[model samples]
Target: MQDKTPLTPRFSYKSDRLKPLRAFCQTVRLGSVSRAAEALFVSQPAITLQLQALEREMGVGLFERSGRRLTPTREGQLLYELAQPLVEGLDGLESVFKDKVAGLDAGELNIAANSSTILYLLPRIVEHFRAEHPDVRLTLHNAITADGTDLLRADAVDLAVGSMMDVPADLSYAPIYRFEPLLITPPDHPLATKTKLELADISRYGLILPPKRQITYRLVDLVFQQHRVPYTVALEVGGWEVIKQYVAMGMGVSIVSSICLTDADRGRLATRSLKEWFPSRSYGVIVRKGKYLSPQARAFVELIQPDLFTRRDYDDSGHSER
Candidate 1:
């Protein structure tokens, strides 16, 4: 019989070799080498070199440059789809394993949330999280939900905490709190005194709303259209505080999330619940589908909802291949 000794493996099992795979995954996800470099905390030239090495080894180009953009080629797309989860799984393995086996002694948890959420919603939750896991470094990226969603997709942030009206298929939202929509007006506005308020009545007055580009504006617009009520936007402002100030100054009436209404706010403005007219706004934790939550992230999520991770079918095994 002929000798049946196995030929040498093409790729060595050195851990550093996997760096190129990670570099390729991030570059494709962000669609630019520079952004990928920033995300990976490496130099742009380093990223480029890694991609070049990967292409040379695979014998196929992965990206096509068009102006400032890098579009993945067909081969690149196939590689990305196959490699992304594997890279993420490997990168997150240590954190996942330690989190499952040892108590939360140390880890980094990055979160994305808007200024409003950081201001109003997360203070207590953050305080508790800090007290519980003093060793875990927690970093919050201030971004609106729309921008936060993009950050989640890129794996830039571990998760997002905010309100989402339209959850993309690739992400999951678990609401921890629900706040009624409120019609905020100065104490003397005509609609404030009416014991029973109607949608048409509110539509009659000019409204101070968030910028038309925001999801809040879209929700407001859709509600008005559904009621066949013609509404006027008096001012397109950005922040809830600024909009509230505008309403108090009598610029226009506005609808806002009741979570923004505090005891201090009650003294300055009159709020009538719009639950009769509009759906309650929900605030929740948003995460990418199939993401492996680090122990620190899982701890914070559990603080929000005791069984949220389990209900979502998260893999809790310390050595899970997934």
Candidate 2:
């Protein structure tokens, strides 16, 4: 009854203990103390000390180390699950407020895109954005489409610009540009003389393709399989430029996105449209479902699609008729 007067808790909003919480969350998010230190602009020892202090205060081990990787324990996982969103919200609050007040003059925008998109599509967009908002920090993470989706899910990137064949349930994709698939061969190759090209015709020669693990390779494989065509992989290169280089070198022909084709390539290579043989690919910006876009991200997205933010046509599944 006397205790009903109520007790004041020792913890307060301005407590220094929250620093350790931030360190813990960053460590968990980055999956290593070194990475967390780099992101936080602190020393590795400082991050380690913060984690140790947090573990001591909580009386539990948070992370287990294996080789260079730091894996969260059950306690760590639970703590992260409960603490991450709050920490991010609090940390981003100042930027959000300033962005609201300043009208997109400041803050950071992180983008994930593959090498091809970065090479072909982003230069002009980035130039435009830079001209408009010089104060905003821009970071481009070079990741393939699959890895880009992973980055989007992890909140590592603000937005991703790439080609996605299958959209995941938790993500939204809005295509801004479409490119046809093309069969590229060296200027002197036998296929260069043929205007009416078919899958069977392309299959007769060795193909310089992206790695078999990539979606492009899978799409190529599926198209050839569906047509009952047998193709040989002479070399499995990584980038479109490399594939194009090899193709131009007369090593093998390649099926590549027309987005990668430019005026410079016209002189070195022979290109024939494969639109009938392969579906056109859409390169677009992908974002997480229910994600709150920052002012910078919103501005960039608007550049991609003027009505992307204003339009309510997108449903929970992230699909729209447009």
Candidate 3:
């Protein structure tokens, strides 16, 4: 009646609806109910039941099995797109609250980067972060592109700092530094003093390069193939430092990024710009597509470059975070 009785609530007050939403979102996120259960510290059957309740409440089929993996239905994907941010925000609430009250005093951050980045790019940034927030714990994992991407997808690392050539849809990268490609040779090498150089000129000498699996080798291979230039590898080893050392000893010449060059190498290695032949590599920060960055993580990332991930566009440059 228009009198004292109130209408029934649209939302069920007897049970918390968040549990079901969390179960559904996690199942969709992980593509496996068991994995979702493990991630959420719940039983498999409980996750299954919550998912069932959520599907029934929404009156739609949410998942269909594709071989061993659970694939979300069209409606389910729409629901997931709408609900996942809510779940992540809710989950990160405590971290956000702590950040507001305590700042970066006692949080932790994990980052993944390759050896070169760790050696050259991160030292200053890391030192500054440590100086500003002494109580915050920071860990850096040495990882290449593939390993770093896997770590981000698994939520094992808060972010990664590296260079990427092809950005996948599920990751975000923000490039902060641009370095040119350079040809490095021992000061006494024949090509070091050549006035006019060409690809053929460089191909005349054996090259000290990273392994075939690394992008540098692949890029060198592609460039040579495109120009129909034949070349030999004097050594196929990893690590730019090692490559530089061997190049200095006249083991072989190398094409390397300028980031690795320093005043220390000027006496031993002759440098020539190869930017015309090779694309400039860009290095930056990487984060998962839908990840909610903790305040500690955010502070560290912004410390490097304030403009990254401003509008939450992951892989904004459509390039990988290598």
Instruction: Show model 3 residue runs off by greater than 4 Å.
Output: 1-34, 37-81, 306-322
For 129-213, candidate 2 gives per-residue lDDT tens digits of 8888899999999988889888886778988998888886446788778999888998888888976667788888999998876
The TM-scores, one per candidate, come to: 0.73, 0.69, 0.78
Please rank every candidate by TM-score, starting with the best: 3, 1, 2
Q: Candidate 2 has what TM-score?
A: 0.69
- Which ten contiguous residues of candidate 2 have the minimum total lDDT? 313-322
Query: What lDDT would candidate 2 get against the real structure?
Result: 0.81
lDDT of each: 0.83, 0.81, 0.83
lDDT (tens digit, per residue) of candidate 3 on 214-309 = 778988999999999999998999899999999999999999998898889989999998887889989988876556777678778767876764
Q: What is the descending lDDT order?
A: 3, 1, 2
Clashing pairs in 3: 163-322, 164-322, 166-320, 167-319, 167-320, 172-315
| lDDT (tens digit, per residue) of candidate 1 on 66-182 | 788887899997887677667877888786677767668876889999878888888988999999899988999998889999999977898899998887645678778998899
lDDT measured at residue 209 in model 2 versus the true structure, 0 to 100: 90
In candidate 1, how many Å is residue 261 off? 0.6
